[model samples]
Target: MAWQGYPALREPGGRQWEASAVAWLDGGLWLHHSLCITEREGTVDVLTLIAPCTCGRGYVDITLDSEHILMDILGDLRPTHGRFPHCEEPLDCGSVHAAPRPTGWR
Candidate 1:
């Protein structure tokens, strides 16, 4: 079946993009990170981060990976130490994997 939410697409010109998907990194034990692709638009030129806290806040939208997407998120997580701003829950980066598309994402 087609993706329920915004699905990955390939343009007639052969450019490809996807709307929302989680990006994962496995770091020995404590450094693992999960960069949630909460929002993607405009040929996937822009991406927004999903806050791991209980408030459901989102980070500033940024242009799609200039270098590497996972590296960017890993850098951002460094400041917070994987702690969400308004919530106690931490992202299960080690367990989370890049999945098929997410549900209820716009």
Candidate 2:
């Protein structure tokens, strides 16, 4: 199931992808992925997503403090590596190796 229904942006940088390199910061199931919003029928929920990487380097996901929550402009909440995580406060970052994400998330 290749992230069914969620909108997917191709790696902007065209670099080979590393699976499991990214994940939700909270350690839940498939929380960091481009989500398949079945309720909206094919709307990929970026809610709680990583930042839209223009550089094409994937970053790890980390929990944003309640104050750090963005208005989900694209979908839901996001902890993006956007240029402005400090806008909110108590920001966090992810640290993981470049490897395929677990198939469970797939």
Candidate 3:
């Protein structure tokens, strides 16, 4: 489950980050504007992203427990227009929710 060799961690450009961000976008989770691998240790990696809230005041840190699962979301998430573009109801402010594993993830 260790992701030391994951492409996102190895690559320089933001392609991998964009891909992951898009996946979250597709899954109705618009908590971040972008994602980057901030730290990698054995079976876990910390992903840092800018919050997409209208206020644009905070960052959302996501912990990937394994290569394919999202263990937790750290930091406060302000109220956004919607969790997803198509969402009719917005997510609760300052709430932490389970994020879906991205498709085509290794």
Q: Report lDDT per candidate.
A: 0.41, 0.37, 0.34
How far in Å is the alpha carbon of 42 misplaced in model 3? 2.4
Error of 1 at 81 (Å): 2.2
Candidate 3 clashes between residue pairs 3 or more apart in a chain or in different chains: none
For model 1, state the Cα shift of residue 45 in Å: 2.2
lDDT of 1: 0.41
Q: Write candidate 3's Cα lDDT for 66-96 as tens digits.
A: 4333312321222343221122234423343
- Model 1 segments more than 4 A misplaced: 1-19, 25-44, 54-73, 87-106
Instruction: Encode model 1's per-residue lDDT on 63-96: one tens digit a residue.
Output: 3454587466657667765434453345432224
Model 3 CA deviation exceeding 4 Å by range: 1-22, 26-41, 47-50, 56-79, 82-106
Against the true structure, whose TM-score is highest? 1
Q: Higher TM-score: candidate 2 or 3?
A: 2
Q: Give the TM-score of candidate 2.
A: 0.24
Candidate 3 least-lDDT 10 residues: 1-10
What is the C-alpha lDDT profile of model 2 across 1-106, one tens digit per residue? 1343433333545633322223433322223433344765775444344442322333335344333454342223234434223232232232332445433356
Q: What is the Cα root-mean-square deviation between model 3 and the actual structure?
A: 11.8
